[model samples]
Target chain A: MTSSPEIAMPAADPKDPYAMPALMPSSADRAIRSFDYADFDIPTRKQEDFRYTPVERVEEFFQPFASSDDVTATVGMIDGSALPDTVTVRTASKEETGVPAVGEPADRIEAIEWAAAPSELVIDIRADTPTPVLVDVSGHGLDLAALHIVIVARPHVRADVVIEHTGSARLAEGVEVTAMQGSELSVTSVQEWNDDSKHVGGHRLRIGAEATLRHSVVTLGGDVVRLRMDQDFDGPHAKSDMLGIYFVGAGKHYEHRTMVVHNHPECMSRVIYKGALSGEHAHSTWVGNALIEPTAPGTDSYELNRNLVLTKGAIADSEPNLEIENGNIVGAGHASSVGRFDEEQLFYMESRGVPERQARKLVVHGFFKELVDQVGIPQIDDRIMATLDARLDESVAAPIAEKADDGTANNNENYAHNQEEN
Target chain B: MSTLEIKDLRASVETKEGRKQILNGVNLTIESNTTHAIMGPNGSGKSTLAYTLAGHPKYQVDGGEVLLDGQNLLEMTPDERARAGLFLAMQYPVEVPGVSMTNFLRTAVTAVQGKAPSIRTWTKELSEAMERLRMDPKFAQRSVNEGFSGGEKKRAEVLQLELLRPKFAILDETDSGLDVDALRIVSEGVNRAKENTGMGIMMVTHYTRILKYIKPDVVHVFAHGQVVETGGPELADVLEEEGYDKYLPEGTTESALA
Candidate 1:
């Protein structure tokens, strides 16, 4: 095996990627620059990649090249845990750990985020952290915001990091994570924003030989939210798991698009995401794409997406795409489904003396618990579960007819009317 | 003591064919301290009485009134019935994915008892209960009934019945999925609950095999959506010697009674 330095760019695919981002200017690419529209092109639904996305709404919410000067952020240990405090956090410019040394942008929104953030925040972990490091990024009254974060886990070490976005702003950020050889890392991104907030981000995870990475996202807030997760193997025998849980509410949109590129041989990846939607016109979408290159002969990959629609007038879109150039691969498969509450499951719980509202809450919580447990970090897992519980209680913990009584839902009559179908 | 009385109960279930009546003008009563064994062949609507009394939404109450201690049970939700001291050990328990047994048990106990059991006592009780049922300690950590064998699920139902401590429990063919050893272990648990709390039991079974373990105080023979005969425990032996064929009308075939 050649001890080669990391390559930021992947071998361009002829037909697999489907859509590519226009690169930044050579000067801006060399050094992080202020907002620049030259690096991004207007996306239209005519493009297959952009068809499911509400491109026009995203374009109008916040334009590229705008800085978040008024916003503030704070990074600290979670819940005052008595964990090791050796993690080093810093803020710097392009020269820091060779900016853009990680994976490249896979879409136009990512390119815009790269050019908009004023500076980069770099976090270096020399060993496994006893406590999780949290970064709370929030915005005040503002039209747009941008930030950049880089996390590096040294060889044979482990690290856990959580980034929480809150308050109001049209926010865009790019996160770069690199796990060196034999290292393990987990990064959780939670979007708990105000009703007026909107966010877009591209997170790139690169792993060295035999390294492992767990990347999870919990999206529960914001009016319009979209995140792109891109994974690439820098060396052979690397494994990664991408997991997420999202709850979409009324007149809001939350979409997650992912691409896992097996550029090295003997690598494996698994992706599982579950979501629930409530309210009128609330929408959620999951798009998973796994591409296996011909040289990656021992590649094994699978992805699954499932959605539960709680009330009427909600939409859930699930698509799993697999593009493999090598027929010699170990295995490859994908599956997705969007469904309503299971009548049998509900009846089973109700028969046990759990109220209908409480039964729905329990069922929804049960649906997400399997994936939440895989988060691998106890404190973070509990925190996500707490957030999920709060969301469930707020929306699904009551009878639909009661929600209609408050005039919060329009077609809640469908909830009890479906009794005939069940 | 609590008494459960079902009077003139009539119910129908919707199928592809149409809404078919499953329970027709049935009547029965059980004091909290007594046990009743419901013996009926398949399609005799024995299980229907258990589910309808427990408030399954699929079973429309065309006409009926179920009173628990003189309070109308039909007016309450399933959970309310449970809180009011009623439980059902289903023939086939539904598997709830992602919900641990410990969590479900705690929630159910808290809801039924109107308070949470202390952690120390709760842990000790659950562990001891699992041991009595010959279940591995790790089974408590598993998702509720998910991927469990039939015997394991049956044991889980009994486990819940014991912990919840309701006034009455409707065991709908609880013996169907058990081997001899499991049947003995489960029946002993039920007997312990009854002896300790005087929890009335309506044990519904097609065969008299389970009756050998837990003796029934009263036995009722059901046919064609109604009870045709009521007798003491000796009736179980009579039916054991003579199959349900005698209960059918002279001209009618026993195929529907299957």
Candidate 2:
């Protein structure tokens, strides 16, 4: 590892067992940011940002290390067509891109990833494309890796981009998106890793004047996945809609944090996230923060988070915070909820001859239909529903499997009978 | 050919106070192609009989049995009972968001029939049923019962009854909130089901106004969780004129009417 003298160092050695604390930030945005590995302290359970995360499971990403070349990335059209002429894709060094970085890292994992990534995979969209651009990243083995991606939408350009993560790896990633003036861009990051994978990612977005951005995060599979998204309106008349969906299974942990900052006047932002948890040890956390500065007058912002707990022993924590320094804003509000399956809905379905398991599936599918429709991509919507169905089946079968072990032959008989009739 | 018998059925519900008994030794029987209207005051357990037969989880069955064509109805789940040719037209249909009315109807039909219906025939049949009920075609695409007016909810219920074609139907206060035109439309749908399927009907209501449209062969006056009197169709007119005053105990207060 190369060490630079210009990097700021902490006052005490973070490795020392008995070192005096240097600094502790009161707010989430006040966390330290640096390029040097030693400047940021190793995250622990005590830190607010890391409290809900399984810090021990992702310790490898917090330390400085060399990233393996096993990770590969490819770009193509969603329809299997060749890349459009209006779009260009190439790998360049961070300095070669010449695009100003949107924001700094907020924590140790992000800082380590920023300093370790060898090059950035940059994709530039000059005009509207016929189909969505697909960036597929796959990890071949269980190895430490780092990825940096920069997406630039030129002035007045319109495009849809999807970043898909699959396979198993302990990786840290940084994705930066810039929507230039008068441009419209939609970016969706889908994390569907293998059962043993661990991932930490940071997404930074900057929206220019008169621009619109629709950002989405869909996390389905992973052992421990944590992502932090920060978006800022750099000019007036910018609008953003941030959406997310996540499903946590047995022994899985998923956390998503979003921070939307309105720094310019007449900017509008909306953030909505929904998640479902099933099976024992399944955990999910969602924290949404919207901040409107005093200078950002006439801003309209709202953030909402909803969670459905499908079974016993699963945990879901939802928190929504809104801060507005300017009372002149059009509206600023926040709402959150964590609840279980509605018994009345289940009963209603059952009364119509739908069995309990199938009834639960229909209700869950309905719960996500609204947000899934907002995704506005048929392929992604179908894929997301298919995965959610499979996971829900597993969740439904788990309790029945236990019931079978307990020798509840009647339930099994009923289930088999229903299956035969179907 | 088919019959539904409720023998000394008793039920109770859990409230803030305690387990309150709602049904006490309620007995009734109806044969195919016959309509029986059960008239009762509020809180007299008329709706309880319908829900208990449908196997709603909130009502606990303390004793007795319900048989549909000689099969024990209480032993089955709600879905199983539905598949066994028993239908309940709820007074207040539930609102299920994001589940389109067409999709819900198709699923229910599939579950009850043990197989899926042909898409071509199903679509035509649904459109025809809605047209007969004076319902807009766009309702098929809307969520089930969501944002529907009272009249619309009742019409949707009757639409299901006609489509499912069950052998026995328990209409729990189906005419409570309908206007004159909506009442006639809904009654026409029920009469069509009877003519097409020969289904037996147990229509529960508080007022006899609906008896004019869906004529009943027998009328049962219910009070204090028990059926006190049974007579012919003319009994409805007697109760409609004099009210349920004679059915109550001597010197019973008006507050007990509900």
Candidate 3:
């Protein structure tokens, strides 16, 4: 093998344009050599799934790096006491009967090596068993380090994978989850990175016969984060639900792209995503594509993307597409909207004595509750609210609070209705 | 006693043919603890009067002043008017998705009360109010006005009236889209509020159906955007029998009844 370059790129200045950390050669050696980065190049336009999202600009920030000791200390932040004692990484050829079988943890989750020893990962969901697992990945100063994790819900089995990312710097995660025949899976990933962290991750999944898969991503923190999720319903009676929610601030770029396919008859897929952006330069993108194969008779699918832009410079782009080639389909449709808070609704609440902050919070909270409630986890629901509250405080909260000192925030009524419609 | 007074009220709404005046020089006064009925034909601006009083944005008040307890009601926003004890039982309530009835009612109650209602206290109060209306408690969990049948939507309006405890309420055709049973239940709910709170009620309607349940002390005949006649409850009987034709000019079917 050619000697790897050890030169490090300049680290991002905390004050100026948020920059990604440099990558080390060791990390580059781990990725699939056959998969060229340019092959998955984000397009400017005309690209079906990347239509609304600015993935190409985001990709310019990515670099390769090796797993560092920074991850060791970061894992301590996660409460892994409830986690299984033994773990093993199960790939296609490394199948072991007794061990839990998973397609593979995405590279993001697998990158977390324990104490210099490679992580012992295992996907042990057995047929007829219904249980969920939490895989936590934490890091510090890892610079554009990448993590990949793969999960497999065996036939007739059920599982859930909860991924929690807490770290700093530029990080990219790749996750692949597969549900086999008659199986079920729910994967929830939460990115609670700091304002300095930049994250670009992709969730790739496939569901089999009579199987169901649900993927939920809650992004409350991150400077620049882009998420690409692709789901394939491969067997009859299979169903998939993809849901996402994000709150972005000024100078933050949050992009989300989703691609779903109903490849077989009697298969159904639904996608719902909602986001809120505030501050002077907050930008967010939402792209949702649902494809129903011509041979896939009786396919049913629905997709909707809703955005709430809270400020003038805050931008949102939504693109929803449906490719229907079959005549025997039950239904196939898509809806997209990029809007601001509803002013009448806001004034309605405010006139009722809810303060400006509380009123905006209620409207935004209500905006996301529809999709958050779909997760069916009350604890996570509460956690999501708390995270949203904190993020709102982090970006817009400061201005609101600062203005409260001068009693100028009360004039928000003027902007209340003005910002309701984009 | 405090009163809700409309002085020379003139309003119009935008239409394809430009602005059309709906309420022209309308005037009325409602005292606290008394019920007033404004009877009119199909196009007599009855609903427009309610919407104007409630501060709906679509109805522009070209001229007039609305006063609540001698305060300028025209100066307040809709919610502010609501907080100041003016409630409008909308002819068609809006369906707000993702906002549960329980939450909306609780918030409105808190706003009207000018402070947060204790959860425990509000729960008991809500249960009592729902029971009085004979409404299933589960209705509170559904989104406000969403997927509700016409009767259910009307009942929900009355439910808000009870919870909000506004001093003055304009019931805009509360009986318009209800069965006999739903009409009775809704009127009973309003009756209870009147008896318990002594709140002033302004019933605006085309048919005389709801007056039977909640009798009006005074009835005004609305024609050509103005209160052309005012009398005791007997006027409602007279209008019901005459069908507004005797008071209307010939070849003016659109403007006279409207």
Per DockQ, the best of the predicted structures is: 2
Candidate 3 chain B lDDT trough over 10 residues, lowest sum:
B249-258
Better of 2 and 3 by lDDT: 2
Arranged by lDDT with the best first, the candidates are 2, 1, 3
TM-scores of all predicted structures: 0.87, 0.91, 0.79
Per-residue alpha-carbon lDDT of candidate 3 for residues A127-162, written as tens digits (9 for 90 to 100): 443234666667577444555566777787765667
Alpha-carbon runs more than 4 Å astray in model 1: A1-41, A61-63, A76-90, A94-100, A126-130, A401-422, B248-258
- Looking at model 1, the pairs that clash are A35-A65, A353-B79
Best by TM-score: 2
Residues A137-220, candidate 2: write the lDDT tens digits. Answer: 897877889999999899999999999999987779999999999999999999999998988978999999999999999999
Model 1 lDDT per residue over A274-384, tens place: 998887788887898887776687888888888878877778877776766666677777767777776667777776667778778788889998888887778777778
> Candidate 2: which pairs clash?
B42-B258
True contacts kept of each: 0.63, 0.55, 0.29
lDDT, candidate 1, B42-102, per-residue tens: 7889999999988887799999789999999999988898889889999999988877899
Q: Model 2, residue B46: what's the lDDT?
A: 90
DockQ ranking of the models: 2, 1, 3
Q: After superposition, how far is residue A14 of candidate 2 from its true place, in Å?
A: 25
Candidate 1 B-chain TM-score = 0.96
Order the candidate numbers by TM-score, best to worst: 2, 1, 3
